[model samples]
Target: MYSVARPCEVRWVNLSQVVGLSTLRSFLRMESHMSRCFAAILLVTTLVAVEVPAVPALPDAQVYAVGVIPDLRGMLQHTSQALGAAGKTLPPGMLEMGLGGMLGDPGLTKLGNGPILVAAGPGLLVPSWGAILPYADAEAVIAAVSGAGLLAEAAPGGVAIGSAPDGPGLAKRMLPALDAVRAGMPADSDLRVVVGLDRLSQAYLPMAIAAMQGAASAPGLPAEAAGQRKLMLGMVAMLRTFAAQAGALRCDLTVSASGWKIDAVQALRPGVLADAIRPQAPSTDRPAERLGAGDGPAVVQMHGCMPPRIYEAMATLLQETRRDPAAAALIDESMVAMVRDCAGALTGSFAMRQGFAGSPMRQLGVAMVRDQAKAKALLDGARNLFSMGVLADLMRGMGVEMVFEPAVRHAAGLPVDRISYRIDPAKLPPGQDAAMQAAMMPTQEMALAPTMWVWGSPSAEIDAALAGPRGAPRLAAEALGAGWDLYADLDMALQMKMQFALMAKQIPMFAGAFAEVPCGHPMRMAAALGEGRYRLVIEVPVEQVADFRNGFAGMQRGRHQPAEEPETPAAPVF
Candidate 1:
């Protein structure tokens, strides 16, 4: 019995061991299969990670921009140095500190500089906009943004901040557009903004048309409402044409120590407007050449040629006006003919300058004449028209009594037939009549020269023009040399001073405002037209920026001040 039990036990143990070994072998096979699957997944994820871009693609938008600053600290330093070279005074490292404070993160200087991507699209009420900013340390940027009370999210190689909550998703969508814009960006460009005019017009034009049509068709409109409606419709049609023909509007900005400069271009697609703007033969007669070099700096100056389309529009409006009884009575067919003739006589080029020298105010205008005889005839017709009883009554109705007369003057051995306007003191406000009369004694004077039409406030301005150039004007040479279609140089300080002085004479509260306001530097603008595009360049000086800041501060102070009681006039004598 013992031998039989031992043999049975041994057999049971051997069977159990064999079963256990079989189970262990099955488990090992299963583990090996799972390991193979894990390795395949690892390979796929590694490939995807390598393929993704550092910056996410930008989503479709109506507007997109990229601002590249390879070295933020270096740019700030260079700007500061340029400002110093341009004679602008600032405390050491003030610009950097100011920018850092504005962002609420001084450590921003440590971030790796990279291209910034921005995008915007139409929204229900406003526009939706977002930006993706590059960063070396995503954690630090996220922390800084959160500390500054802004929304932040981690991106592929940077941080995303935007108006929406899902900034990371937005960054991913913008990646493609960001890549495209970066590839096309000019090497020297610091900032470029692109506007999809077609998309914008599509989104906004319907609302605009509906609103305008509603207004135009409203009941109880004026007698001239029909003509006004036509004009409005015409404008809308033009805007539609512009949108259909224009690709995009691109504006580039470059900031340096000298000043801030912006260049905006609108490229036109093949269309009627493009054909109209095609380049023509250059004209030898430039209007800026006619302007006389003043003794001192000019308060304001402008030179440009009116496009043919403007004249056509004017003619159309005049025709519309003639159809209305009330309008026709005010602007008769004969008057329209005279205006047309005057416009026809002009070569389209014109220049104007206003200064405060040789008189309280010196103003001059020069228009190149295509037909001197026609211009002279129109001048006579204008004088007669102004002297007519109808025009006299019209002026009287507006509290202005104008006396028009013809006078002959000689300047630089040239006879000038001048038509001058004298204001009637009786029509002016009491106690201010004499001052007003003094301010506007030689209100207007016009003369038809052999090659040009000259006009000015006082006779002295005409004399200066007839005497020829005293010295080179400030911006005339530069504008003409560059063949700019439009140019303007305005001394904001002088203009404001003149305006304030005039206003103070009538309004006592404005007496010391001019003195308190800081002086601004001259602001210059230059524009040119190409075959299928338009270019505009603007330069805003640092002094002008300071002036604007100070002006706003003054306005804020005035807003908080207590209101003063309105002065009661003395009882009128019986």
Candidate 2:
């Protein structure tokens, strides 16, 4: 539905090849009589000559995206050259021969861009010119489709029908609406399409919202749950606004073997988006401050944020919930107490920086200011909660130990304003020794090795208690197990090479294409909101346009393949 830039060329090429191969195989399987063979060959040739035409041109408003793909043959040539410059040879495969034959031999290249027009209607109408179906017989194909109930009438140019009419047909309806919308723009567009959100909203949004409202009013629902209905209504309102704005939306895509990019813009009208979302002046109540000193791979800092109105809204919700007797009864007392005790931890602004320098260290610094006295009290409460029988058992099983590293006093330092929690799996309780040892034992799928070991109490009292002549072993089994287990046996370099090999094997075009794309390929997205307009754009770099044919082959094969099960992530220790 959304007209974003995508890889389509290689797919179509591969599809045509698959169709050709299957037809050839069928011909070979028939009775080897000369008469039958001749007749079948003629039939197949006739069908091949009547290649499907490109999509028909529609009115400008009906089209969502217009793009041109650089000739794949040319792009592949460029890729081969680039790879040569990088001193890398492309993998040998059948895809290379397919690309060289279809696009042109990289050795004997031709240069030209192929245009693809996408119009919105009963289905996507793709008007391609001098692209895939270069030898198509337009008139005969159109006549065939009209006779086969695939089309009512053929539009101008080498266009094909996507499907039979489901209703009065999008073309018929869009033509009538053209005059009405013409006042705002031109009489016609270079490309015709009509599936814009504005058109859809005008045709169905009101009815959809009404139906949702009806569903929400089902019997036996409690009156106090009106919040749910209110939330749905709010979402509907936003959707309506977005649909209205989309009337003036326009998108354009430019695809190349080296890179692909798209630009889209939507006109905004006043009083459309909610007032709460309107840009507000910087909050003066919160003073500006840096999040932290940076030594980590990622850094995020937000300051002079959180407008007053947002807090007012939260307060209003809290008051309403407290007033509702049923809602108040469901609120947990411990949770409420926790919130009250920890509220001082959020002193307008806070900074948290986490990194691994030999070992992972997480530092959280809060601006408690006048509420500094409450930091210790909040931390002590947290320690008590985490140290409980139920919580300690769970934490120990997961090989995690939480310690409240009490705030250290310095010469004229604001230590009270900040509190820190240190996680040291090595300091787990003695009772968990056997469990830790068992967890570290190698499994069938993976192996673990200990790298660092620690023994003796981290605190003086415990160390003194075991200060006899012999004492315990220098490295405690539990700490050694936890530390050693952290050193996982993974060959990242070998894994990456294996993954590249697999992708290339599955998709032939990948050999030439993968050479041009840097690992993780660059992707960029941007958006902007203004007084009366909003716009968003996304860009992706594509390499070796000819390689897309493999994608098409995959799709054709997918039709007969069993659906694969979706992969799920491992369960969290918690």
lDDT of 1 by residue, 330-349 (tens): 45555555555645666656
Task: Summarize candidate 2's per-residue lDDT along 46-156 as a digit string, tens digits.
Answer: 011111112222355443322222234443544554443334446543334654343223322222233222224323233211112111344554454456555533332
The local distance difference test score of each candidate is: 0.53, 0.31
**Leading candidate by TM-score:** 1
Of the candidates shown, which would achieve the greatest lDDT relative to the real structure? Answer: 1
Candidate 1 residue runs with Cα over 4 Å from true position? 1-61, 64-104, 139-157, 165-174, 179-189, 197-247, 268-273, 286-289, 304-310, 313-343, 373-442, 467-472, 476-483, 506-521, 543-574
Q: How accurate is candidate 2 locally (lDDT)?
A: 0.31
**Span of ten consecutive residues with least summed lDDT in model 2:** 37-46
